[model samples]
Target chain A: MSSADFGALKHPFVLRALEPSDYRKGYLKLLEQLTKVGEISEEEFTARVEETRHLGDLHHAVVIEDVERLAIVASATLLVELKFIRKCGKAGHIEDVVVDSTVRGQHLGQRIVDHLTELAKQLGCYKVILDCTEANVPFYEKCGFGLKERQMARYFS
Target chain B: MSSADFGALKHPFVLRALEPSDYRKGYLKLLEQLTKVGEISEEEFTARVEETRHLGDLHHAVVIEDVERLAIVASATLLVELKFIRKCGKAGHIEDVVVDSTVRGQHLGQRIVDHLTELAKQLGCYKVILDCTEANVPFYEKCGFGLKERQMARYFS
Candidate 1:
């Protein structure tokens, strides 16, 4: 199904990219709901915004905002990458997906991921991928992604 | 161990980033050694270079060169990323690792990954990640990368 068919918020909530003003405050509340729980001070937020602004457009941080409430409710990022092996030569990796704990079960997470998946297709990516815990597999499957491979990592000091 | 102690190629082989001239011919040779097994033409390689050059320093296309033979003998790319959860606020993703089939046993792949891991550390990344097939797991383990997690993926058409 097209992204439009994917369930989206109604009424006063809107889904869009974060603005400069969001860097000062508000996003931290929504960020706390992600798998990583924390409070990011405004200074760090501001720095990250500038660093990303300079890095250009490959990183898209999609935010679900409650227009009337003036708060971010849900969010995810689509990281597009150029590749050497894919038949289409590009790939999109979605990361840090989350829905506000207070707003779970509303299907906002599905809408946000669907939007990014459509964007990835439009950008000619051979694949749109994300790594989620086994518990979250069913959620991604709901968003039209099928489970395929395993993930590996190494942490450094 | 420091990146310098990472067992680099001996004799006339040197490791470094790909040069502009590499887009014309030698990269295809080096690419063949990667598990993907294919030839990338000059036009495609040039276009990809232009596309990613705008992505800035994150994509380090490190290559092993033979000063005496004047050819790229091995190659790999390290993609560094910023994050919200890590203590260091960044991550390193290694991709497209290749070691010339002719020079495969010399530990060129190990040095290339080691260099990128150190580069990632210097860039303040808290972890380094890469997805390889089950067969290649032992090779990455030799480079100080242990099996920690499974990498799951979903492919889109």
Candidate 2:
């Protein structure tokens, strides 16, 4: 649905691909609403945006924008992976899913995840997957995601 | 190290970036040695290679080559992910880490992992991560990787 087509939205909002200008200021503002994020300089933000853009159609930065103030209210990323496996030989990873607390009950998160999942299928991903916190498990389940493996990670910092 | 730097070899082998020519015949041979994979037509193989190559430096396909047979015998992929996090602002994913069973225990797996880990650092990734089964955890730990998060997934078919 278009950002302006937010008839169900108490406020006007649209879901769309993140624009270049949105990264530095607008994105950080909406992102920090979900979690505490370290400050990123505008130059770094611009460079990183360009880098992700260069990742081609396999990567998508999707966000919901409030039309009135033109502010982002939610966001998620879809990363398609190439694999040497059966069928489609590709996989999709959904990450950084978040909705502004102010807009939580609107089911915006569900819509965003659903949108990305469809996009992954269109991209010929054999499967769509994600890792979420233990508390977020039920949320993903509600969005039609099934838990299969325990999420694991390693941080060098 | 250059592919030709096989001077330390007890057997004839080289490590190198996967060339487009390796996609169809050589890659499949090595991949099958790792696990059972479905057949991939030459057309599909070529198309996928071109698509992945278009992904630029964000993804790396590293392989071990059998000098005598002129074929890939072991392989790993390094994917760089842009993140809105601290430190380097990016993460690295190591996938498809496999060594040919015929050449098992030659330390080729360790060398390949080490190579990709270094590539991640150079790519400005704050951390390098992968998901492995319990049996393989010690192998990765031996290669200087430590367990951090419990792995999780939602596979669609």
Candidate 3:
């Protein structure tokens, strides 16, 4: 569905690319419900958003904003990586997906993921991939993603 | 280790970022050693390289080049995603890692992965992650990556 089609969401909720003004909209606060979100000032938030904007259409940090409440209720980022393989095919990586704790049962997470997955296809990606904890496998499956491989990480202090 | 430290490798082998001129150096041909690489003209290759170049250091497509042969023998990309969490922290995702089949025993894959892992740390990434097939588990483990979660994928035609 196109951005114009988001009217299907409840009156107050709309999904769109993250904006600089989201700092005041509790964007970071909503993310804290998913993982550690250290204090981020408005300046830093806007600067980072500008840096991502320089990446052109390659970075999509989609968010579901509650317009009536002036707050972000859910978010996820779809990162497109250009590749030399598959004849320069693009690969889509969905990262940091989260739904505000208060909006748990609303299915906002699935809506945002499906939207990004479709965006990936529209961008000519050969595949869209994501890594998730065991508990979240069923959720992603419901969104049309199938288990593919194992995710390995090395943390840096 | 810094780029200069790559001298530890056998003579003529060095790891570095993907250069525009790499198109003439068999970079795309090298990737075909790992996966399907459809016909890509030199013009297209250089154009894509230029586009990726615009991303600055956020996209690092490192390669192990055989200077003597003027060919890219191994290659991988380290994509850094800016995050609002952890006070604007960054996360790194490694993709399309491959070592030429002809030079498999020289440990080029390990060397390249190690270099990118170190690069990610130097760039202040909270974690470096990758999705790999089961057969490659032992390989990445030797490079200091441990299984963290499952990778899910949805392919688009």
Candidate 4:
């Protein structure tokens, strides 16, 4: 959905696509709460944003911005993979979902996930999946997702 | 790895990118071994292949073709997602991994997955992940992936 499509997002909060200007809005800073996000310059962030923009609907780096504070309070990305199964169906992989620590109780995580789920449905996705820790399963279950399988990973050194 | 970079495969078998002509090689039929594949016309398959082709390294749909049988015996896709984490790093999501039932015992699944893992590393991904059934846990563990988390999903009707 477009920024306009999200309607009024609790007054000062607006959900929208990651903009070039979000570099100054603590976008990367917010991500540090999730994982190891090292030093990222504005040029690097802008280049990546342009690359994602070129991908159109296939790459959505969505964010909830606090207009009053001029900071990114929550973020998530939905990467749609078109498949040969289910007659060329699409699958959505929700990644890097995080809500800033200070804004935890407002249900922004659910809101962002719900919005992206809607977007995935609109994009003709047959299923939307995500990998989360056991502690986060209850949160995701509350957001309409069910525990399906185990996630396996290999982290580079 | 490129088709050339994959070194040599077993006799009459070659690993490479999905081709436009693979529609005739039963690509969708091979995918059927994994999940439901509805009636997919050649036009639709070609369209999707072209779209994936345009994405270059971001979408790696590697396949193992049996020249003698003139069929695709195995298939998997590695989708590299550029992330804001790990200093603007990339992560690989391996999906729809399936080996033709007829070709299961030859270690084709491991070969395909290991190749993709190497490609992910070459692409500078900080990690590679996949969701699998409990029954398949040992297989992915054999491929050097450790059980990381639970996978959650929402399937659209």
Scoring only the A-chain of each prediction against the true A-chain gives TM-scores of 0.85, 0.87, 0.94, 0.96
Ranking by lDDT: 4, 3, 2, 1
Error of 4 at A149 (Å): 1.4
Query: How much lDDT does candidate 1 score?
Result: 0.72
State the lDDT at B113 in candidate 3.
90
DockQ values per model = 0.44, 0.40, 0.86, 0.91
C-alpha RMSD in Å of predicted model 2 compared with the true structure:
3.8
Model 3 clash pairs? none
lDDT by residue (B1-157, candidate 1, tens digit) is: 1243333558788876666677653766567555453566667777776766666567766778887878888888887777666431777888888877887777788888888888888766788888777888888888788765445455664
Task: For residues B1-157, write the lDDT of model 4, one tens digit per residue.
Answer: 3442675789788888889899999998888889899998899989999898888889999899999998999999999998888888999999989999988899999999998999998888899999999999999999999999999999999
Residue by residue across A118-150, what tens digits does model 2's lDDT show?
Answer: 788777777787767677878888878776643
In model 4, the Cα lDDT at residue A111 comes to 90
Give the CAPRI rating of model 2.
acceptable
Each model's number of backbone clashes?
A: 7, 12, 0, 0
Candidate 1 on A66-139: residue-level lDDT in tens?
77878788888777777776431777888778788877888888889988888778767777888777788888
Say what the RMSD of model 1 is.
3.9
Ranking by DockQ: 4, 3, 1, 2
Best of the candidates, DockQ:
4
- Model 4, residue A19: distance off in Å is 0.9
Q: Interface RMSD for each candidate model?
A: 3.2, 3.0, 0.9, 0.7
DockQ score, prediction 4: 0.91
Candidate 3 C-alpha error for residue A107, in Å? 1.6
**Tens-digit lDDT string for candidate 3 (B1-157):** 2342445677789877788899888888888777899999988888888878777668888888898999889999988888778899999889989888888988889998988898888888999999999999999999999999999999987
After superposition, which runs of candidate 3 have C-alpha atoms over 4 Å from their true positions? A1-6, B1-7
